[model samples]
Target: MQLNVERGAPATGKTIRLIQTARASGQDEHQIITGNAYKPADLELLVRHRISRGAKVICIDECSEQHIECLQRLGGRLPDELTIHAVVSY
Candidate 1:
């Protein structure tokens, strides 16, 4: 599932709803969770979701390529059996 948050609105509840809907529809099997740095805590929750679903983790950050690269590298190092993914904001 792909979620495109428009204008960075603080729709925390909406974001959670997106997650819930994705899970219910079996869209959480594989994902690339992306979010900006301003929502670090929320991004963490996305990571947890991917981990729980046994899906690969890919985080996208528009603020800092360095941070995104670092996160991708870290994701590459995880055990092959574990598919939890996370992208840390810059």
Candidate 2:
């Protein structure tokens, strides 16, 4: 159960690296959480749903204005057995 956050400038491959790092530990079961696909208000519910479905890695895309806030809202809602890799590139 490792929880880490990686952040860098946009287009620096930070997100890709995080995904790869997460996959190294998971069995190809990573969930990509993007703001474009889900509303800001529904991110928590969706992330929790994905996690419950056995998502080992969570990638919070940097394209959303509330990405950081969304990450913060996830404070203590995740399972200890899961690995979270959220990259914020502003």
Candidate 3:
């Protein structure tokens, strides 16, 4: 599992975007996941979706601490391919 941290993940207003709508390739994939980081259930579900669907990257829009914690807990499940792009705003 490789980890990539970046700023400015896609989101809808104050809420995070919570679904994988597209596939990225070759140096273009920073990693993305969909879900409201503030919501624990959403974070868990979104992360699980990535695992179940075999997504290579996890991108959370408006990522909160819960999102990061969720990743730390379940990230190992992803095994070989895993990328995380966490967005934070100050």
Instruction: Give the alpha carbon lDDT tens digit for every residue of 1-90 in model 2.
Output: 454666677889886776676567653434556546667668767777878888766666653557556656666666777666666666
Q: Which runs in model 3 stand beyond 4 Å of their true positions?
A: 7-38
Model 1: weakest 10-residue lDDT segment is 1-10
Q: lDDT ranking from best to worst? A: 2, 3, 1
lDDT of model number 2: 0.64
> Which candidate would rank higher by TM-score, 2 or 3?
2
TM-score of each: 0.33, 0.66, 0.56
- Candidate 3 on 1-90: residue-level lDDT in tens? 654434443443322322332233332234444335248666776667766877666656565666666667766666666766565543
List of clashing residue pairs for candidate 2: none
lDDT at position 75, candidate 3: 61
**CA lDDT of 62 in candidate 1?**
37
- Give the best candidate by lDDT: 2
- Kindly list the per-residue Cα lDDT of model 1 for residues 1-90, writing each as its tens digit: 232222233533444555554466455623434455435445545555655666543333232344334444545545455433222222
Clashing pairs in 3: 18-34, 18-35, 32-58, 32-59, 33-59
